[model samples]
Target: MLAGKVSLKTVRSFVLHVFVLAFSCLMIYPVLWMLSSSLKEGNEIFVNAHKLIPSVWTFSNYAEGFKGYSGQSFMVFLKNSFIVTISSVLGTVLSCTVVAYGFARISFKGAAFFFGCMMMTMMLPAEVLTIPQYIFFHKIGWVNTFAPLIIPSFFGTAFFIFLVVQFLRGLPAELDESARVDGCGHGGILFRILLPLLVPVLITVSIFKFYWTWDDFFSPLLYLTKPEMATVALALKNMSDNTFGTSWGMVFAMSIVSLAPVFLIFIALQKYIVEGISTTGMKG
Candidate 1:
C-alpha cells in the first residue's frame, strides 16, 4: 500500500511538471517564431510560417537591416538611443535620490504638501500631458531636439522618487543621527553614509528607466524629424515602407537586435530589481 501511494505521488508530480513546461512553451512560441523567422530568407518566411526551422538560413537580413532605411546606419539609431537612455538614467538617479532623501529624512515647511503633490503626479496619465508639453517645448525651441527627450529626466520622476522614498524609510533614522555626531552635514550624511547603501534601489531605478526609454517609440516619433536623429525604435517603424515592400526579414532581424540590450540588462540585474522592491519599507 505504501509503494502504491509513493508511485501515485510521483505520477502527479510528473504530470504537474509536464503541464508547466507545456504552458511555458506556449507563451514563448511567438518569440521562437520571430527568432526563427529572422534567420529565414524573406520569400520563405511566410511560406513556412508554421515551421520553426527555416529551409535555408541567411544572415543577409541582419546586414540589410543594419543598412538603415535612408543613408544612415543602424548604429546611428543605436547611438542616439544609448545617449538618450544613459543621460536620462543618470538624471533620474540624481534627481530622484535627492528628492527621495528629502521626503524620507528631512523635514521642512510644506514638505508634506509637496510630497502629496508629487504622489498625485504618479496618478496622472502621461497622455494627458502630451499636448501641453509639446506646445511648451515647441515654444521654447526644444522640440525636434534631444532636449525634449533628455532634459525632463533631470527633474525627479515620481515613481522612482516614491520607490527610493520607500527604500529610505526602511533604513533606520539613527544612521543620519550618528553621521551628524561625526560632524557630518546633510550633504555629508547623504553622500558619505546613505549613498553606498542605496546601490540596489538605484540599480532598480536605472534598469526601469533604461527599459522604458529604450523601448519608447512614440516620444522619439513626435520629437525626431530628422532620419539621423532617429532612435532604434523609430528607425524600426520607419523601415516598414509602403512605397517599397516592407522587408519582413530585415524588420525581424532588427527587432531582435533592438531587444538584445533590454534582455541582457534584465537577465543580469533582475535579481536586484526583485531584492530592491521586496525589501522596500519592510524594515519600517
Candidate 2:
C-alpha cells in the first residue's frame, strides 16, 4: 500500500510539472514570436508567423529602426524616455513618501477625512480626468513639454501613497517616540528614523513609476508634438507608415529594444517589490 501510494504521488507530480511547463510556453510564445519576427525579413514575418526561429536572420531591422525620423536617431527617443522616467520616479518617490508619512504618523484634524478622499481618487478612472487635466495644463501653457509628463508626479499619486502608508503603518510607532526623545523634529524623525525602514516600499514605488512612465504611450502622444521631443513609445508608433508599407521588422526590433529597460529594472528590484507588497496591510 505504501509503495502504491508513492507511485501515485510521483505520477501526480510529473503531471503537474508537465502542465506548468506547457502553460509557461504558451505564455512566453508571443514574446518569442516577436523576437523571432524582429530578426526575420519584413515579408517573411507574416508568412512565417508560426515559426519561432527565422530562416533569414538579419541585424538590418535593428539598424534601420535606429535610423530614426527627422535626422534624429532612436537614441534621442530613448534619452527622452529616460529623462521623463527618471524624473517622474524621483518625484513620485519624494512626494508619495512625504504624503504617506503624514498620513501614517501625524495626528491632525480631518486627517482621516483627507485620507479617505485620497483613496476615493484611486477608484475613479484616470480617463475621466484626462480632459480636465488637458484643459488645466493647456491653461498653464505646460502642454507639448515634459512638464506635462513629469510635473503631476510631484503632487502625489493615490496608489503610491496608499502603498507607502500601509507599509509605514506596519512599522513600530516606538521608533518615532524614541527619535523625538532624542531631540529629533518631525523632519528628523521622518528622514532619520522612518526613511531607512521604508527602503523596500520606496524601491517598489520607484519600480512601479519607472515602468509606468517608460511604457506610457498615450500621455506622450497627447502632449508631445515635436518629432525631436518624442519618446520611445511615440517614436515606435511613428515607425509604422500607412501610406508606405509598415516596417514590421523594424517596429518589432524597436519594440524589443523598448522592453529592455523594463525587463532589467524588474529583474534587479523584483525582490524588494515582492517583499514590499507581501508586507503591506499586514499590520494595524
TM-score of each: 0.94, 0.92
Candidate 2 local lDDT, 227-258, one digit each (tens): 89999999988877564367889889999999
| Pairs clashing within candidate 1 | none
lDDT of 2: 0.89
In model 2, which runs have C-alpha deviations exceeding 4 angstroms? 1-6, 275-284
Error of model 2, residue 107, in angstroms: 0.6
Off by over 4 Å in 1: 1-6, 275-284
Poorest lDDT segment (10 consecutive residues) of candidate 1: 275-284
- lDDT at 21, model 1: 100
Q: lDDT at 108 for candidate 2?
A: 96
Q: For model 1, how does the per-residue alpha-carbon lDDT over 1-284 read when each residue is reduced to its tens digit?
A: 46656787788998999999999999999998998999999999999597999989899999999998779999999999999999999999999999899988999999999999988997798999999999998899976689988889999898899999988998999999999999999889999999999988898889888888998988998889899999999998889766547889999999999999988886888787667557653210
Query: Best-fitting candidate, measured by TM-score?
Result: 1
Candidate 1 backbone clash number: 0
